[model samples]
Target: MKRRFLPVAVAITASTALLLTGCGSSGGDDDSLGKAKGTGGGGEDASAPASPSPKPAGIKRPEVKLPKSFQVEFAGWTNSDPKLQAIMDDGKERLLASYAAIIKGDPQHSALAYYSEGDALRTGTAWVKGFSDRDLTLIGKGRVYQPQPRISPDGSGTLFYCVDEGKGSTKDTKTGKVTATPAGDAFVLYRTKLRKTDEGVWKTTMVQTERRACK
Candidate 1:
């Protein structure tokens, strides 16, 4: 997590962010999702039955668009399962809007509406507060690359994506001085778990983030 791209309390230290196992891979080109287990190994048990998947909830994921101000490019999402595809498609918009809201420093922004009442909401509030407290604003463009959707046997879905902030920057509010540049040895990776609400909205339940650097 680079300093310029992070919002106050949401900022992760670079040392811990760089701990990802491999730094050589671009984190792109891998569309494989988690695999399901099957019965019968070398010597299988005859009495066992395979686990059944949950029925589709018929929920519709909402559509999201990036703000014209931020030049964020997404690698796109992929999922072979129809139900899970709907879930991922909707989740991606909320995810992007979350980032956009942070960049704009607007707590009341519509993007903030996507976050539920957990870490996601807390982090979103912190981002807006950081800008207001420091009298600063973000001034840069970034990109994100995420893998296909991976749904659990119980129906929860996990999405892993990388954020490249090397091209962005931040500046002071009053002095108008360039305080921070986005480029550095660091980038960010996020792992978010989402579950549909009873109201049929796909909300993020938990988010795990790690900052990594280019080798």
Candidate 2:
């Protein structure tokens, strides 16, 4: 998904420092998604539990949680090949980690660092910061579907997916006012680069997004 800024009354001088539109991008680091830096502080929510589903062996997974106000749905996440499936799983987790950071108002969330790195990390950090800077948080639901995973002989990987933000919106962290996003701004396509670490973690290294690329 590409970066989509909140529709708040406040004017954003930088277009790249924003939140996920329907699609996810590499935050706002690249021209496609725009750029910004993330800020704030917090830790994993103790009430939330780690995903109960089995993950690839030897991979250290972080516990990701979203508040009751926010929800994300993933479609078609399975793959016949274990390696490719691992990529899909990690890719999903990375996106979740990003949202988790934003919701907790913490740009330095450990899960974000655990799931992403390099340009992807910088972009995500900026995106999360954009919200924290404005005292904004997300509410409602977003959907991620149609995952397409590819593996390179050199060992790097890529995952492409679609996001629907039509049902999502932003809420004021303090006043609790909610701003609705236009449906026209929903639906985005995202491409992400991944590399497996020695610890067997698939870290997102880069991300690109296209606006209105999907229905």
Q: Whose TM-score is greatest here?
A: 2
The local distance difference test score of each candidate is 0.50, 0.69
Estimate, for each residue in 1-215, the C-alpha lDDT of model 2 and write its tens digit. 44446642111213333323433544433322332111111121122332434666666678887887888877556678988888988898898887788788899999999999987888778777878887888888877766778786668888877667777888887998888767766666667789999988889987766556655
Q: What is the TM-score of each candidate against the true structure?
A: 0.63, 0.77
- Model 1: per-residue Cα lDDT over 78-158, one tens digit each: 456776665665556665666566556576566556644465566556555556456666555665554445666666666
Error of 1 at 130 (Å): 1.6
lDDT for 116 (candidate 1):
46
Candidate 2 wrong stretches, greater than 4 Å:
1-4, 7-52
